[model samples]
Target: MGTKPKTRFGVIFEGAKRELFSVRELDNGDLSIFFKAPPFYDFLDGRSEKTLEHRYSFHRSLNSTPPAITLMRTVALEGGQIIRTSQLRWRAGESFSTMVFARACPTLRPEHYIMKERPKDTVILLYPIDIGRTTLFYHVVVTDTSLDPVIFRRSGLWVTSETFGHFKLVVLSGFFLILPFHRGFVSHAMTSKMRVDGQEIGADLPPIDLGNVSPERLLIDIGRMTTLLAEGLAERHISYIREQRYAERFVTETRQLLSLRPVPTPPDLPRR
Candidate 1:
């Protein structure tokens, strides 16, 4: 009888030359490395299939030990999908997920969570704060409370990567749950403004090139801001539905929206 191959760990990434590479452990504990040229698809133009070629092989070895790879599942927006794979779940720890719903009041179920499929052009990243709560960062605002009845505004994080080309990596930054009406002697409001060291930023400013900034320094800034935001939310004592409900609803909706779409691809290099 033939014996099954032992499992091992490895890493995978998309190369600059439009190739997919993998470094995985062999049955005898040795490592194997190789690359594959993905079928041509105009990902930027969205004319072809969006299927990703490379994926984490963890799902294939369900009976393995120590889990060949650890992964986190995220919603489809912000470059996440309901599909299971390593690359999609690669940054699971760093990634957060949430849903925005129109809340009629603090003690009532949200009418329904808001949904947006094409958030790449404006949304940067999404940060999970808590169950049913998230933070979203925006470069542009196509739909706001003024035009539509969006009670909560989820914050998303934005980052740059070589594989994605001009397309920014969007992640969960935080969540903003809006109450339909003032609930008590206190209230809060959302703004399209930001400040660095007390210097206010204009809403019409262009997106910053992340390449020129130190990731550590930027993270420090984001952390401080996120802390402040959380503290402020706590102070407000805004009561709303918590996680279990939100999570269940989120998962169900995400699955329903899953479809074979073009795998998000990198855009042309940023102009020098």
Candidate 2:
């Protein structure tokens, strides 16, 4: 008897099941998230590009009104033997819960995947992937028994949290949020008591009063707030050396595997 050969799907699933990101905390109370480019999904966007490195920052939202973190994605690309960088901003909504928000893996429980009547197609798995010591996250995966890879017809809701708990800030919803006042937040909502999942992480922020607003003197107040943003966090400069090394090693190995696969080029487009 001989062992079965590993398929491309098996290799992908193995790598996908592992922890995919590294994390650390910055001196300025910001969280840093580091991840590698997808091994299987090489063409993240439409181009002959592959990712080299990624530097993500979960910092204070400059907008302030949303009570979300500034999710900045900085990726280094290698295309045509030329290295370039790209950047973008996203928001990780504040939700401070460690329950089903993360860590819902079948390996931990085993009983969850043993349901008799539950449809396999409907089974969605969310596992807690420890990127670093600072925070935890849910890695979404779908149940698949076949060797063929299939796309899961679902989108993810990115609910993130800080070490202590959720932010006690109110995010104004709907069209009213488009208004310029209160940094796009409703003034009354900012001072209102809003709790997330009944967990109060921090003290409520007082109403931000811009006393007798004048356009000329606004720069003074903005300067003070900018200085305040740089204050140190309780856990300053936490490192994720081990996780970082793991992701880097995975990336190197994936690149090796990718080199073995031939990339298709169109006749109209010249190869780089």
Candidate 3:
């Protein structure tokens, strides 16, 4: 009998190299196109109420331009065969529109959560690219409300050994979430650093400099009771042991201090 190979999540970035060139070309083209248009004006004829809104429509257009890269998903089998499975495309010039939608209103549903959809948004265009034997596609999806939760909580932490630039962490807090994004580059090595409540702690590091003392020292300074509270939230067995040890040490020290009484000189036995 053969054993099944383990599968893991991975991200493959497309057209990353050509990103700068594509953006520059798109910006120049948009600028030239808008420069030919005349300025807007308002009229007070009373027949119609039209006002001039000269608000850099061209700049918005340029900012909304999509990247030339394409994104896709792949699956690999145990025997070392790679299979291209899913096609994930990027939407062009939909950034601003989506931002507007999210700012306006937001909603959450189980089914629509995974797939990106915008209720009050429109699509601009779809661009296709050829990656060797694979054909990739990019579509612009826009919305007036936030599309979806950036982080997948069930998956926990997503780590990669590639480059630090490609790493991303999406933290969800309350009704809003934050997505911290970075780009991958071949010239630099990937580094991972972690800090708990502004204090740096954890193994596997290029040693994140949190500008504060080490986590152990911080906990010690805060006292044993507070340290235990933090350890409870961490929910890690190792952390519990660490807290216990710290408490034990603290108790021992306190007892030692209490036991030490001022040594009596015995008054030199009344000068003997």
What lDDT score goes with residue 18 in model 2? Answer: 32
The model with the greatest lDDT is: 2
Model 2, runs deviating above 4 Å: 1-17, 39-46, 61-69, 79-272
TM-score of 3: 0.15
In candidate 3, which residue pairs get closer than 3 Å at backbone N, Cα or C atoms, i.e. clash?
A: 64-93, 91-139, 91-140, 101-144, 101-145, 102-145, 102-146, 164-190, 165-182, 165-183
lDDT of 3 by residue, 183-235 (tens): 11111011232232234344563532212223234223223332333333334
Q: How much does each candidate deviate from the true structure in C-alpha RMSD?
A: 22.2, 22.6, 28.6
**Better-scoring candidate (lDDT), 1 or 2:** 2
- lDDT tens digits, residues 1-272, model 1? 44322211111111111111223333543222221212222333575433333222212223444222222121122233232212111121122211111111221122212222232212211211111222222111111112211111222232222112111111222223422122211111122233323344445443322122233443454444555555454445433334577546645644543532422323431111
- Which ten-residue region of model 3 has the weakest summed lDDT? 98-107
lDDT of each: 0.26, 0.27, 0.22
TM-score of every prediction relative to native: 0.23, 0.26, 0.15
Sort the predicted structures by TM-score, highest score first: 2, 1, 3
Comparison by lDDT, 1 against 3, better one: 1
lDDT of 2 by residue, 125-242 (tens): 1222211111111221111122111111111122221231212211000110010111100000122233323333346656543222221232243233223322211112122224
lDDT of 1 at 81: 29
Which stretches of model 1 miss by more than 4 angstroms? 1-109, 116-163, 172-211, 238-272
How much is 82 displaced in model 1, in angstroms?
Answer: 36
